[model samples]
Target: MTNLYRAGDLRTPDALAKVTPEQAGWTYSGMEVFDLAAAESVTRVLDGIEGVLVPLSATDVTVTVDGDRHRLRGRVGVFDAVSDWIYLPLGSTVEISGASGEVALCSSRAEVRHEVAVVAAEDVPVEVRGSGRATRQVTNIATPSSFEGADKINVCEVITPGGNVSSWPPHRHDGIGDCEPVNEEIYYFRMGQDDSSHGHPNGLGMFRVYTVDGSSDETCPIFDGDVYLIPEGYHGPSIALPEYPMYFLNVLAGPLPERTMAFCDDPAHHRIREEWTDEDQDPRLPMTSAESRVS
Candidate 1:
């Protein structure tokens, strides 16, 4: 295994400032690619644009500023099938997308490995409307007992398996807490098949992002290979219509004095929380054994 720790140390202000998207050859799509040095600087620029990084192949990029390091990785392509890991120094902001393989984000000193499986739970919190889809949670690190003293990152995957995860009453993350400030997040989507072995995969799911002043409705159109980012504001309960079971990969980072999520519920259906019931796990879940590889 290659030790990628050195790549993380080179993303200083001066080095990053000297690079540009053009010189780095960061194309929207193509065989065009960058090595570790160029990839690091390119990630900085992408970070500035909140860049939507498309993976040309399974790739890795690491950036370190001063003593802090941040690393980003792409899913290893199906054929090569090699697991990749990047290390970020403590406090470096890192975002990862297009990862079908296992991943991790941690303080540089922490010995976190790629297969560690950082997601918190299999069955997550969900709120549903009468006819819409369900907001099933895949991972969460903020449970009561886990909230030791300081808040950790909040990462979850929302599945619209049958187009039922969206279109309820829209919701946001503002004022959800008193002890810690709100965090920023990313949404990565995995589009469902047109014809599931079970059913169809199409229904217009809506997501809106907004602030107290106003909101942007239907800003994110759900589709395969697209990623929507939440720098701040209300996101949604994605509703999958009759077709389209949308799966969302969510990543959140915030500064919380304590490790708990106090979300600002959507007032429209906040009352629904009172009547919710925990459904038994769908036997179809865990889709297949984790060790099983796609042939």
Candidate 2:
């Protein structure tokens, strides 16, 4: 009936690994955030699903997928950090350990066991979406159109600067049609600092979910570490609280083998998409060197 979750409300992983999809009332989709200290490690077994390890704030680390070992670079924060990910195929055992920091193990049920590939941070293509206040940075790292290793997942992230809105024009990817793909989505949020806004050190943001057929709707507060589920409905206009930048990692999957980012924009609010045509992209966007271009 609802699709919003606060950070502390969601189930967290153990000291090493945790699955979040089932905890959020979802099937075969979610991310596991694991923390490790210098020279520490943990092992996770994937029986029927695949895992993608995204470096959140890594320090000298290595993710061993099956038998291959992949090195990792350290990042201070998600906002200004680059991208690096290790892909784990089904029926494989992954051992992750390193100097210190955190990483998100994004997973989804997969029947096909693809080859393991590590996507380096430098290769991530960051682009600008929308214009003016709606402007946000997009990093299409493992989307169906981008990465080919994964057989079922379509992952991406958006970064909205303080006081801005992204995921605008209310869109949905429910049911198969021209642009619709019967997919379920999860939004894992990470907020940047705002000494002028909230007193908490973690940071704050907001997101809205409203049904299209008058079924239901609600807006939820977002803080660092929050995750929201979008089972069905028109969702959009996620807000970054004043002075606090917002970042969200999107995990998507469906019945189809080929994944995509296609969706139907709410017709009632579709006009707003074209109205910003005259304005320039917000200068605050493309917040990091990981960004490649804008479209």
Candidate 1 Cα misplacement greater than 4 A, ranges? 1-132, 135-137, 141-152, 166-169, 176-181, 194-205, 278-295
Instruction: Provide the lowest-lDDT 10-residue window in model 1.
Output: 106-115
TM per candidate:
0.49, 0.90
lDDT of each: 0.36, 0.76
Identify the leading candidate in terms of TM-score. 2
For candidate 2, lDDT tens digit of each residue in 1-295?
6666555565544543344557656666766777776336878898788888787766567888878888877465676566677788998999998777777788888899898887777887878889989998888879877798887887888888888999898899877345557678888888888522211356887788887667688887887777778877778889987788888888888776577778888888899888898989998668765532222
Please report how far candidate 2 places residue 63 from its true position, in Å: 0.4
Candidate 1 lDDT tens digits, 124-240: 233223322344434232233432222233434445545455534555554444413454554545555533422123434445565545644445555543445454456666655
RMSD of each: 11.6, 3.4
**Candidate 2, pairs of clashing residues:** 38-99, 83-121
How many backbone clashes does every candidate have?
17, 2
Candidate 2's C-alpha runs over 4 A off are 12-21, 176-179, 194-202, 291-295
